[model samples]
Target: MPEVTPQQHALFEEQGHVVIGPILPPADVARLRQAFEAQAAAWAAEIDTPLDDYLAVVSQWTNVWEHNPVFREQLYHQRAAAIAAELIGCQRVRVFHDHLIVKPPHGGSTVPWHRDLPNWPVAEPRAVSCWLALDDVTAESGAMRFMPGGHREPVTRSIDFLNEAKVWGERERDAVPVAVPAGSAVFHHCLSWHTSPPNSTAGWRRAYITIYLDATCTYDPTRAAWHPMAGRVSVPAGATFNEDVFPTLGPGLSAAHLATLRGGAA
Candidate 1:
């Protein structure tokens, strides 16, 4: 597994977010892209709305691993999981969920500034999201802008992405846009204030994000009672997330255990 450098660790601790990678090889990036296309096509066929219209309004697909084998394998990506654990300073980390967000060229809307922990159902704020770029991303192509050290702020209510702005009174000038090549990733804290502008370029902007929480994080329905993944949790409130659904990942997590999680996908 890959490791975060001392400097990278320090930066993440101070800034609430840090870009790392190409953690994935070109081959892995290509495979993920192919899987995305396949999943998109499947979605298009099932929806009554035109694919373009759907892309414009609902460009995100959650827990894609359940429907796609490629993503199922990627769900256990050791490098990403290891880095997440290291950054969180947790002995183990477990999946909260994964989603693919695509910003169609000149079509997608701006994602308003917000902190993720406020929207999650987990009890603690100890979590990190691995945002993997599936396409070369730039400021004009919908790359995320993050407020440095924003995670230090107290957790609050979730933002209305369609209407709210200045969630924490963060100044736009202080925020920094982060762009990366395909296969690279950005690891960000759960409470980091971040947002992305609409894609202005002709090329699509795609990102696959896997959120990992400290294994000790427990369910807290009061945080986000209507979270999509809430229904998937078998445990009661204040209990650790069900390991069957959110498999743990770390040094002692063996390949056989991951294979068990993969089942047929393995």
Candidate 2:
């Protein structure tokens, strides 16, 4: 399948998002789900909690590429990489991070609507995330909801979840639910305001999210962006992604790597 089409690019630019179905074949999806379950089980065991009773898990494996070969493989997958390249108009992109969000049955929690860039240390405004569904996601099962053109809005005051009323503002008119099937993926701009409601269904809602930023994207360390509760981490204050945080993984793409590859820089 073509990694990206002109129509897809246009849609992303206009709507600030795009959804692609079956981006991961059946086998690929199965493998990823297996990996996620294993990781989740191990994590739950360490925390002295029952795996089946967890509410919402986020950012379990920070540097996933270092621990899981499957994650490493996915980071360099041609389809994902190509799509990211096209979306960011970069010659090469690097894996910013990977997160596995699992909402267990009867998990009642709302991920407040907010933009990721405000939470990240990256200055690049072009980063994108691919939310790959490992299971069928529905409105009742905590499927992601996004506001159209939300990315265009200026960054608002950061929300403190402790104060629910203070954090969640009035819902925008363009906000809509995004229901995706297994093996499908939703592409969203980093600045898009989005969130998911609680999963009242009996089954788990599983999603594998990977964020990609162009190698040339700049970093902004003022936000002190780091993993949740992990404390501050090292990142260049004003350099592009490649100069500091993002590491190159693919082979034989060095020339294309320096210049944004998607725009034919190589």
Candidate 1 lDDT (Cα, whole model)? Answer: 0.86
**Model 1 ranges with Cα > 4 A deviation:** 167-170, 250-266
Cα miss at 17, model 1 (Å)?
0.6
Query: Which candidate gets the maximum lDDT versus the true structure?
Result: 1
lDDT of 1 by residue, 1-266 (tens): 32777678778988999999998999999999999987887888787767677677788989898889999899889889988877877667999999999998886888888899988889999899999999999999999999999899888798876677774453668998999899999999999999999999999999999999988999998887788988888999999999877878756444554343234222
Off by over 4 Å in 2: 53-61, 164-171, 225-235, 241-245, 249-266
Writing each residue's lDDT as its tens digit, candidate 2 over 1-266 gives 33677677777777778888788888988898788778767767878888765435442356565567786677667677667767777666767777777777777578887777777776667788988888899999999888888788887655666674323347565578899899988989888878888888998788878888876666676663554512433545676554233564343234444243344322
Q: Each model's C-alpha lDDT?
A: 0.86, 0.71
Scored by lDDT, model 2 comes in at 0.71
lDDT of 1 at 142: 94
TM-score of 2: 0.83
